[model samples]
Target chain A: MKLSIIGVGLIGGSIALKLKEKKIVDFVCGIDNSQDNLNEALALNIIDEKADLEDGIKNSDVIIIAIPVDATRKILPKVLDLMSDSQTVMDVGSTKAGIVESVKNHARRSRFVAFHPMWGTENNGPKSAIAESFSGKAGVICNREESAQDAIKMVETIVESLDMHTIFMNAEAHDLHTAYISHISHITSYALANTVLEKEKEEDTIFQLASSGFSSTVRLAKSHPEMWVPIFKQNKENVLDVLNEHISQLKKFKSALEKENFEYLGELIENANKIRGILDK
Target chain B: MKLSIIGVGLIGGSIALKLKEKKIVDFVCGIDNSQDNLNEALALNIIDEKADLEDGIKNSDVIIIAIPVDATRKILPKVLDLMSDSQTVMDVGSTKAGIVESVKNHARRSRFVAFHPMWGTENNGPKSAIAESFSGKAGVICNREESAQDAIKMVETIVESLDMHTIFMNAEAHDLHTAYISHISHITSYALANTVLEKEKEEDTIFQLASSGFSSTVRLAKSHPEMWVPIFKQNKENVLDVLNEHISQLKKFKSALEKENFEYLGELIENANKIRGILDK
Candidate 1:
């Protein structure tokens, strides 16, 4: 397989490295707007060569879009328009509904697969790519019925080569579930980090006391705004719904504390501990 | 030094293991309300022997209270009443103000040192005790001036033996700082886990989508409420203040999302990212 990856950043670079590691792709072509990123990807040997979109499309068996969701939404239709019958296009965008909807009416829609490999870190760029980035994680394929059987199979093959479990769901359900499980986590982390940063002026103190569960809870706060802002913008309604629920939960905790209702607070924490059964599996 | 550890659970058990590994304690006697925990501690070699609270105190030169904050508040004075001038008492409770105040008027008040080791995990019991648990973490000693120099030196030496950096603050300041840096993190994580569990009915989906980030963000939700509830109850006012601030921050993000104000959301995230400077240090 010849794989062409757009963006050439964390997700794209990771997929390229993983595919090359698995010997699933004979050649990888990177198409990135940032020449510096392309240069870094080349220096890291993440891709065999660099090419423009047209040249990348003409030369590759598969094209993977791994840019921010808003950018992916804008460029997906053009990429779909340029797809050939034998070539398949897949996306690794965090938000699927907007990107899937953007190309819904394209004539070559069946040649495109809407995918979200459920893996990422706060770190970014080609330098942060890992061959095992997607290993043991889920890869969501939204609106699988919309894609042709061959295109779906090709994307599934890629997901399998990356050692990911495949999950098929509608675009709406995909966005909603991710907002509950993934997107809300980032929002909570960011808000928690800002809360500490805002209230606690002692930087050295936070550094010293970070190990007491603060570090992991705030780890996602370091995520790049360039990646997450577009996700929040594209999945506004779903993110808003979850964020509202999260705020209400925080308020419930606050009120319990205010009323000195230790029993109620304990019950809330006990209820929350139920996630252990699900997450530990 | 001889050591007696009350409540041979996660915190207590871990301290015993690390002290034994470092050969800082010639012997560690275990005392807990639960016979099963005491038996497990003995069987796991986390403690040298089992003793009642009175027996443990009489036989050891130093007593370490590693119980929940509420339990610590109730038992601290009793332990202090039994202490000899040559003996010292230290606590590893998450909240300090309540525990410190509980023994403030005791005749042997100067014999007690209030300490909070800035380390923990979701796991519990003797089997979960680890030798390297406190390494590279901060150890806070509250109201250091209240304890005698010998008592303070003994606790600080124990902290150093565990390879932790010592931080000294008054009881009020210790409680307040922990509320911001540690206690609120657990609340956020528990609420986050509960939020996802309440909204997303599909447990299988959460299991499949448990990315490294999601797993870490919700890790503290797996924490036993038995350990956390008393901390929240004891540190009610400070935890409430930080929780309210955290809720307000979450509301800001929610409002931004509801208003489709991507720019504001981006700014919030960028501001949150400033935590990297403090945490990565």
Candidate 2:
């Protein structure tokens, strides 16, 4: 089998590496616009070969769009236009509703499947790819019925090769749940990073006093802006709804402190501790 | 050498385990208020024997007070009263200002060294203790001048045995810097957890869709309230100040989203990305 991957960054490079290792795909043709990324992916043996976008798509059995959500939205329709009826295409985009909507009325719409792999790190670029990163994570496929059975099965096979369990949800529901589960985390981490940067002038002190807890909370602050801005733009309303709730929740903590309500503060923490039940699940 | 640990929880149990492994302390006496914790510590080999507080202090060469900050503040003076002139005492309290002030006028003030080790996880209790957890972490000795030379040497030896480097700071600076770096992160984690729990009613969806980034950002929400409420109560002013700054920082991202300022949003994330420099240091 042959797979053509678009945008050879962390997610794309990782998928190619894993599929090749599992012998699911005999060849992986990396189709990235950046010459540096292509060179890095090739040198690291993350892909069997680097090919031009048009040639890569025409020769492969499947095509994976692993670019940023904004770029994916703009390029999905064009890719679908280029693919033959026998070929299958799937996107590993973070926001699904927009991508699914962009190719909704296309003649080749059924050839494409909307998929999101629930795994990531703060780092990016081809060099940051890890084959083991997605082993225990979720791979959500949205608007499953809109795609042809063959396309859905191909994506499911790819997800299984990556060692993730499959989840089915409509495009709208995927966006809503991701807003609460994923998008808001990046915003909080970025703000927490900026808070310490703005208020704490003694950089040496911060470097010395930082604990493991602080590092974990702000780890996502290092994520690329190019990737996140488009996600926030595409999922603006849902993200805003959650962000407002998050701010209000923080205010509850603030009010508790201001009133010197220790008991109330303890209650808030105890409520938060309930996350253990969900996280440990 | 012999050591007495007043509270056989995460920090104290960890300290005893490391000191014994390094052969710096041949015997350890546990003095936790809860019989369950003492039993668990003994079963896990965290402490050699359980002893009464007064008897334990008189027999040991050094004493470690590792309870909640509020409890430490109340018990510090009494512990100093029991110690002989040659014996030394140190605390692994999260907040230092209150603990230092509690024994300021005591006749044995110089025997108490105010210390805090910069390491922790969401889990607590002796069962969560890991001796290697302290390696490569910072151990801050606050108000070094207030401690006697012999007392300082004894605490410094303990830090070395834990395989951590020592950082010296005054009590006021430790509280202030920790508010910016450590204390505020917990509040944010607790708040983030509450935000998700309140808004995302579908527990299964959250369990299925949660990315590593969300889990990382909210990991500290699982910390026990018995430990945190006292830390907040002791360092209320500093925590409140940093919390206000953090809320304002989050508002910047909200305003950018509300105004549809993608350029400004990118700028905010790019600024947050600067944290990589400090974290990687």
The residue pairs in collision within model 2 are none
Please provide, for model 1 over A1-281, each residue's C-alpha lDDT reduced to its tens digit, 9 standing for 90 to 100: 89999999999999999899899998999999999999999999999899999999889999999898898998888888887889999999888888888888888999999999989999999999999988888999989999999999999999999999899999999899899989999999999999999899988878877785888899999999999999888888888888888888888888888887878988999899889888876
**Model 1 docking tier (incorrect/acceptable/medium/high):** high
Candidate models: Cα lDDT each: 0.90, 0.94
What DockQ was computed for model 1?
0.85
Residue-level lDDT tens digits of model 2 in A1-281:
99999999999989988998999999889999998999999999988788988899998999999999999999999998889999999989899999999999999999999999999999898999999889989999999999999999998999999999999999999999999999999999999999999989999888888999999999999999989999999999999999999999999989999999999999999999999999898
Residue runs of model 1 more than 4 Å from their true location after superposition: none
- Determine which window of 10 residues in candidate 1 chain A has minimal summed lDDT: A204-213
Across B181-263, the per-residue lDDT of candidate 2 in tens digits comes to 99999999999999999999999888888889999999999998999999998999999999999999999999999999999
Q: Pick the lDDT winner.
A: 2
lDDT of the structure predicted as candidate 1: 0.90
Q: Local error of candidate 2 at A101, Å?
A: 0.5
Error of 1 at B246 (Å): 1.2
